[model samples]
Target: MRDHGIAHIVETILDAPENMTAVNEIKERAWQAGFKAGYNECLTHVNPLFKSGFTDERSGFHGIDIEAVYAAAVDAYNNLSISAIEDIEKCLEAEDYVDRLRLLFDRPGEEDEAAGDAKNDAGTSGTKVD
Candidate 1:
């Protein structure tokens, strides 16, 4: 995503509390805003393609569905990765993302065991994806 730069974060913290923790919090929020801004920019660029109704359901359903899933995955990944810790959030996000994919691809009545398996796997790894 687009990096709005540390300058903005610095300016923000400079006007706020002088505590280091507050500074860090401001920096984190700035990082998140920058990330979201970039994502929104992407969506703005792509919106025109879908707005014209040129894509019929039978022909474009799969592509549109996949794009939606990808957007959701990106949002989940962004939120999970905010702490920059590759240990906990990374694993949780992966498990949840996989579970969602399974839910989407599996037949309606076939998801019972797969979800259980995912939860068990994530639990054994020290994180509950549910």
Candidate 2:
């Protein structure tokens, strides 16, 4: 049996130009989705107050610093985006491991036939016979 490691699988994937393009596209989309989610969450918490001009005359003085809010939103967006990309990378690595393990253990063309033979020999209850 040959050893097919996760690194080998990853290297095979990365070596293909098309796969590299696809991977880049996937990471870009993940980053965009994370940024949108983070920005939307920040808006949910701050949009109402800011929409009303950040002041309520009846309730004394109220203010929201636009620069500070923008900075915070950017920071949150960056953090979320990075985390999303990392998660995507981790999933890809895990998939590579699975692929490597499958390649290492799965014999082509014989597995299905062997399984069928075993099932037929064992009967429905799966008891082995001598």
Show the lowest summed lDDT stretch of 10 residues, model 1.
1-10
Report how far residue 74 has shifted in candidate 2, in Å. Answer: 26
* Residue pairs in candidate 1 whose N, alpha carbon or C atoms collide under 3 angstroms: none
Best by lDDT: 2
Off by over 4 Å in 2: 1-10, 51-130
On residues 1-130, what C-alpha lDDT tens digit does candidate 2 reach at each position? Answer: 1233345445544555555555565565556555555555665667686774422323211243434444554555444433333433564465343333444444565343222333325412122333
User: What is the per-residue lDDT of model 1 for residues 8-117, given as tens digits with 9 covering 90 to 100?
Assistant: 33443344333444445545555555555555565666679677433233332323444444455455544542232232234346645434433333344432443334
Winning candidate number (TM-score): 2
Q: Candidate 2: TM-score?
A: 0.33
True-vs-predicted CA distance for residue 1, candidate 1, Å:
46
Error of 2 at 48 (Å): 3.1
